[model samples]
Target: MSVNNVRNIYCVGWNYRLHAQELGNTVPESPIIFTKPTHALVEMTGQEIPFPADQGSLHYEAELVLVIGKAYRPGIRVDELVDRMALGLDMTLRDKQNEVKKQGRPWLSCKGFLRSALITKTLPFPGIDNLGKTEFVLQKNNQEVQRGNASLMVFAPQTLVDYIGSRYGLDAGDLIFTGTPVGVGPVNHGDHLALYWGEKQLGECTVQLG
Candidate 1:
């Protein structure tokens, strides 16, 4: 799938129970959907990444991403429409997000900055049955910082696709970020960030604060 041809970028929030609790938030009964523009996308190719330094507390959110291969149809299963899957980073400006949350404002400013969405190479999706047994991890400077699987998600892939598709609608070329787990932390300059799907290392890159 060509990332450049992506149409919409949908992201789920508070999908993991542990992630919600870690942030002192309650587990939401349903998925919380958000969006990012196409400009936020950046492919992870072992390059030096430059981040906006003025944004306070730049956070790295490692997530499983779904690549929608078919057009939307109500009541469709995620696995039916998603042709591939990948590991991704949904970068956030934590302090700015907190400030907006206090005011009950949209999170676009904090979540939709240029190059905020980072993705790895797309892999043909193993069946959902097989996927349930797999997990993804993120390491900061060679130290494991986050680990998560489908079992701990508050809203699973099925629920997310159904909700977002039925309510807002999804289409071909859309990407859904299935949310992150606990152990989310700020990214700093010179940090070596590595992402993995099970034992398979996806990619790695170094961070540089702009």
Candidate 2:
């Protein structure tokens, strides 16, 4: 299925130990949840992404995205409910995010802007068992800037689904962006971004300052 099949887009923050520490955030005792509206999605069609003007430090966060294929049921396992997976870029306006945090505001303006969520074509779910071997990354200008392995996630996909399902009610078409690892960094005009699953390049696009 394509991005059109996707419903709610849920995201986890501070879910990686090193990522949390790098951001100077306390390691959360529980998963920190947030979301992006469907409007934020932009398929990696090799189009140039126009960065929001004046939103300082646009950052690239590579994450493993799960496509929920079944209706939510309390006892269901991730492997049973999800049929596809993909690599995504959770683009953030870092400076704006930090400014809003100090004022106790929502991250919506900093995260849910147009074209903030970049996604690629989905692949068959790499079942929980093979999670250890499943790896993804984001390469900026031919250099690997960020990478993630499901096995290294602090809150595994199952746990995220379990936690989010209990409170938010995940639907069959919903998408859960598990979380990003420690190497997130800034994006800029003229920069080329690519997402990879192992040696396979899933998708790509160029950045153009808006």
* lDDT (Cα, tens digit) per residue for candidate 2, span 1-210: 767777899999977789899999988888899999999998897888898868689998999999999888999998899989888999999999999999999999999999899999889997999976967888999999887888887888889999999999988889988888998888778999999999999999999987
Q: Per-residue lDDT of 1-210 in model 1, one digit per residue for the tens?
A: 677899999999988888999898999977899999999998898999888999799999999999988877877776788999999999999999999999999999999998899999899988777887888999999999999897788887888888888888888899999999999999999999989999998878888998
| Model 1 stretches with alpha carbons more than 4 Å out | none
Colliding pairs, model 2 = none
The lowest-lDDT stretch of 10 consecutive residues in candidate 1 is 71-80
For model 1 the TM-score comes to 0.97
Question: For model 2, what is the C-alpha lDDT against the true structure?
Answer: 0.89
TM-score for all predictions? 0.97, 0.97
**How many clashes would you count in candidate 2?**
0
**lDDT (Cα atoms) of all candidates against the true structure:** 0.90, 0.89
